[model samples]
Target: MLPEEGVNAVRVVVGLLVRGEYEELETLTEARRLTAAEIAAAVARHGRDLISPPDAAFREVDAVAVPHEPADEHAFHVEFPLWTAQDGLSDLTLGLTVTEVMDGVWTVELDGVHTA
Candidate 1:
């Protein structure tokens, strides 16, 4: 099990993703090229249309805590169940890595994403 602080970090970052909090997301990412606003716009623009339907908004997200990831022992898996724009089922796992930037402050970064 992840420590309470680490779990909180993961939840906070994922919550930002769900809420489309671009400005805050910017600070959380390690991407050197794209800004958080750019990422947010992209997610909003293609979210449901490309992922769900012609114009279906990203209504909601359901996440499940999975076991520790084999690829990265330092990271953890959070599975998100979603339906495609074609109405087909697709699942995604967010491999998140949280680093202790300072005393009580932890920085969570998007390590990678697995889609199935």
Candidate 2:
């Protein structure tokens, strides 16, 4: 798959999580800081359903961009730029995880996040 496709897959995963956790994210303020480390911890405590691949682990990363190599296949890498109005948050990159659970059925998970 093209790198663009991979990025899209990642975006889908992120969208689901955000939509699912919109209420909590919206309540975030400077007083209510939601650091990447904190979020990563939450993913560990409350399953984020972020990823599941052959040998993939359950962990979260703080990132703003999940870089994808230009020459990649089977493992598609795509990027989705996120913008936020909340203070101290300008962007969030959700790493996309695509898996072939069944024939033609694909699963997605936001496994990586860019903080830098």
Candidate 3:
């Protein structure tokens, strides 16, 4: 099972893709290992009429916002922009941070922690 925080982030990204918002889905440096952009693109590309442009159609994401999670192991978190010209969906700015809380663990252990 995936960590709830990671799962929630994946869900939100997948939800955004399902809604046809595949523009400017940049991957943060920290999350390079997760291949978030590739995953998002794959999820976004799953449907017909969903075009993966040669280049991102939206503005460049300045940063990624990572939601709070446990204080152990490693994790990837995202930040969405405040507002965007794209309708229906929220602005897609912000940043993503991949953290390594502890060494040697392949994934974070969020069993005992609460996410906010």
Among these predicted structures, which one has the highest TM-score? 1
| TM-score of structure candidate 3 | 0.29
* lDDT (C-alpha) at residue 108 in model 1: 63
What does candidate 2's lDDT look like per residue over 9-96, in tens digits?
A: 4444455445545333324212133444555564445333443221111222222332433323143333443333342233444444
Return the candidate ranking by lDDT, descending.
1, 2, 3
TM-score of each candidate structure, all chains considered together:
0.50, 0.37, 0.29
lDDT of 3 by residue, 34-89 (tens): 34455455434323222222223233322333444574445554443322233323
Best by lDDT: 1
Q: Lowest lDDT 10-mer window, candidate 1?
A: 52-61
Q: Please list the C-alpha lDDT of all candidates, in the order they appear.
A: 0.50, 0.39, 0.36
Q: What is the C-alpha RMSD of each candidate to the true structure, in Å?
A: 7.9, 13.0, 12.1
* Model 1 agreement with the true structure over 1-116: per-residue lDDT tens digits: 44556656766665666565757776766653346766655555545422321222112223233444443334333344434454455454445556544456655656443454
Task: List ranges where model 1 is wrong by over 4 Å.
Answer: 30-34, 41-46, 49-90, 112-114
For candidate 1, the lDDT comes to 0.50
